[model samples]
Target chain A: MLPKKVKKRASLLTIFLLLSVIGVFLILNALNKNILYFNSPTDIKISQDINYNKKMRVGGMVKKNTLNINDQEIRFIITDFKNEVEVSFKGTIPNLFAEGKGVVAEGKLQDKKFFIAERILAKHDENYMPPELKNIMKENAE
Target chain B: MLNYFYNSNIFTWIEKLTNFINSIFFALLIAGLSFALVFSPPDYLQGDSVRIMYVHVPAAWISLASFSCIALLSIFNFIFKIKHLTLITKSIAPIGLMFTCIAIVTGSIWGRPTWGTFWAWDARISSMLILALFYLAFIFIHKLVSDEDRANKISSIVAAFGLINIPIIKYSVEWWSTLHQPASIKITGSSSIHSSMLMPLLLMFFVLIMYCALIFLMKYKTEIIRIKKKNLKRL
Candidate 1:
């Protein structure tokens, strides 16, 4: 049996910490949209209050075979499997931006179907390996 | 029981521990650096740019871990009313702030090559900036407040509130989409990071932990000395 003072403080801290953790989750749950940094194409399509002229971000995989590039601009379609947004950007994109890879386009929604991107940022998945190991893994999958 | 915390007793032990740590620190740092810079292979996709993870990841870990330590000590001090606990927390704050800054800087440097921008006001990045702000508030509370008791009380509450942000930072990637990638390392379940890269990352993390330990011990020793000097003046 421990002293009451030790026990009291321990219990108090535990309660305080639990409340803080639970409180955060509740607050985050309520303020989910505020905290979410970017919206997927599906989010844009579903949300009712979306402002077309207001600049926003739409992140999703660069749809395969939809990329159409020219000297002045690059056009591609981003998809979340459920929905898709066509994005057109004039600026240079990141090296990692590729078809069938994660990409986040920042700009204005031209309409429900088209987005004018001011900038394109590449998003990578969690996997990390050397080129040789990545090649071996790819070979195994094939 | 109180005698265990006698300043002179703790002070003497601090000296020996600091010296022992100093002797081994350089060797470990050299090994860690060599493995991080030379031995580690380039990323399959990211190539050599991924090497920045050696400093960036460890600093991020240290900053987060240090905040948790400070918050725990603060709670113990408030409950147990232990002056020794306050010393420990106070010693930890600056180190936490330093590493928090390091993590942000190194992360941004790593960002340019990958994210195309040095900074973005995304959830993960913004929350981390808020964390650095919390550290500043914790340190400034102690420095600016004249009454030691009041300072401790205020700082303890501040740390408790700051504790809420820890979970936010950790889950930010998962809770929301951001420019930052999801964590590759995990405490439970399988990690996505390869063993070859993991080795150097762990080595660098160990070296930074040792560095933090050295700084904490030295700062703690000084706090004890300051208390003793104050006591002698009262006589």
Candidate 2:
């Protein structure tokens, strides 16, 4: 028969393991909505009830020749090739923000087709290529 | 190995080494801070406020390293049932918590000037906050549980459970689109930061590591003495 101390240790270990599993499950479940991913134009397009008030990120390539620069606002079109959404912002954009580059705009959706971005993130790759240019390079290499 | 360490003069040697390093750490800290604050050029984007990176980054690094040490010690203690391992883990917790607090506060101070806000629910900051909470839970478990062996068991379990957060914290900036900048130093490639700025940052990192070591050694010595006194009383 196991000693009393040994039995106590075993039971404690079992309880600890059980608690850890439950804790992980609960945390992941709760964080599912908060752990936001960059929604493609298609994802935003297909969704029925778009979140207009909550801040969300939409990521895609800045469409070439669609960028409009004025003294007041900078506007561009973000496309996932299948669908496109117009984005407008007014600020000093990141140095990497250029046409035909991948960008993630963080703000609320104005409607199904328009996004008013509070912050424009210029997404880049490891090799210093803008994400959109990197994809194009890959496609050309193939 | 445990018996050898207990019987030999290793702890005394560690004490002396840490004492020696303590003086060097102070000297380097003053010099590093001067160089970082006065000598280093202001960042183009952040201007003078970027100097806070010298303190915030190193403290964050040390806090993460300390937690990694606690997790590793907990694993060894659980596997081998070594009392010394548990004692060392217990000693490191408070110091680790202090470093985590420094990182957070300094980060917030830095954020106000740069990010225009003290706090955001960004992934990197949130994950770091979670890590600090785990450290708190570890310390609280040790205090609440009266039984020595049981306390060690539960605290070690907590430390091991908290190990999952370290990777999440490290990769949070890259994995999520956060306001926090991506890591300048990459393992496979050379650092992207200029060498002029990198020098003071590296020196400050060394100073913080030495500081943590000196504190850890002192705390571990105190724990050993307390355990010895308790054992004597029991006898």
Candidate 3:
């Protein structure tokens, strides 16, 4: 048999490792339940039984010329190119909210085609190419 | 040999190096702040409010880095039974806690203008709050325990366990839908942030890291001296 002191130390280390593993497992499982996945318009279209009442996120490019801004509400069409969903938000949209930009709207869906966005988040492109370089690329492509 | 290295010249050399770096860091801190606040270009989307990133991002980065260091040091202490490693861990805890606090507060201020709310139960923000709590618990365990050896072991266990939160915080934005933006600075690929804005942000990050190292070294040295004096008294 191992020495009593060595056995005790080994058991202590085992217990600590087991506790850490269990704690991390429980925390990640709990967080997974609460996480809201951002769905593209295509995901929303393909999934037939999406819960309409629960709040969800719909992210896609804002279709060009679909924006309708009135004093009371702002409306736009978010498209994944494969499918499109119309979003209407009453709140003041973010400054980056514009046609053809990427956007994520969070709220309940009135239907598959209609989304009442409680919050509108403008998502910018990750590219940070200089304007002069961008012009050069555009000319080369042309 | 180890005692000679510790006694003869290494400590003096470390002190000199620390002083030199500390002076350079102070100058860089002032210059970086001025450049970040006044000279850097306003964000294309966020405007002047983006200046907050200079402080908030670096604080967040440093706190994560500090916890990672603590976790690694805790492991080394466990394996090698090194007293100095635990001392370093003790010295780092309060500094990490302070940086976590700065990150949270500055993030709240930045969120108010950008996200239109001071706070939200978003994934990224909540994970950061958990990190702050871990730092608090680490310090609390150290304070509550009377025996130095017991305190060190317990706090090290806590620090090792809390290391799980670091990866969660880093990946929270990507894994879940959150108001907080995705990382602007990519590790392997090109950064999303413009070079004009990134330069000042990087400068501030360097200054803050140097500041953390200086404080950690000073605190570690003091702890070592205190321990030595206590041992002498017992003798």
Best TM-score goes to which candidate?
Answer: 1
Q: Model 1: what is its DockQ?
A: 0.64
Evaluated at residue B214, the lDDT of candidate 3 is: 88
| Tens-digit lDDT track of model 3 for B63-163 | 99999999878865654466767777889989999999999999999877665667767788999999999999989988899998888888877887888
| Candidate 2 residue-wise lDDT, B1-235, digit = tens | 6876465586778778887996687788889889888987765444576678889989999899999999878866765577888778888999889999999999988766655457767788888999999999999988899998888877888888888789888988776656666787787888766666778888888888888788878887888888889989999
TM-score of 2: 0.76
lDDT of 1 by residue, B127-204 (tens): 999999999999999999999999998999889879889988998998798889999998899999999999999999
Worst lDDT 10-window in candidate 1 chain A: A9-18
Could you tell me the lDDT of residue B132 within candidate 1?
Answer: 100
Candidate 3 chain A worst ten-residue window by lDDT: A124-133
Encode model 1's per-residue lDDT on A1-142: one tens digit a residue: 7679888977887787788788877987998887777799889888899897788888999999999999988999999999999999998888888898888888999888899999999888888898999899889999
Tens-place lDDT per residue, model 3, A1-142, is 7567656765776587778888887877786746544788888888878898899888888999999999989999999899999999998777777788778788999999999999887665544433555567789999
Comparing candidate 1 with candidate 2, which one achieves the higher DockQ? 1
Q: Which window of 10 residues has the lowest lDDT sum in candidate 2 chain A?
A: A124-133
User: After TM-score superposition, what is the CA distance of residue B1 in candidate 1 from its true location, in Å?
Assistant: 6.8
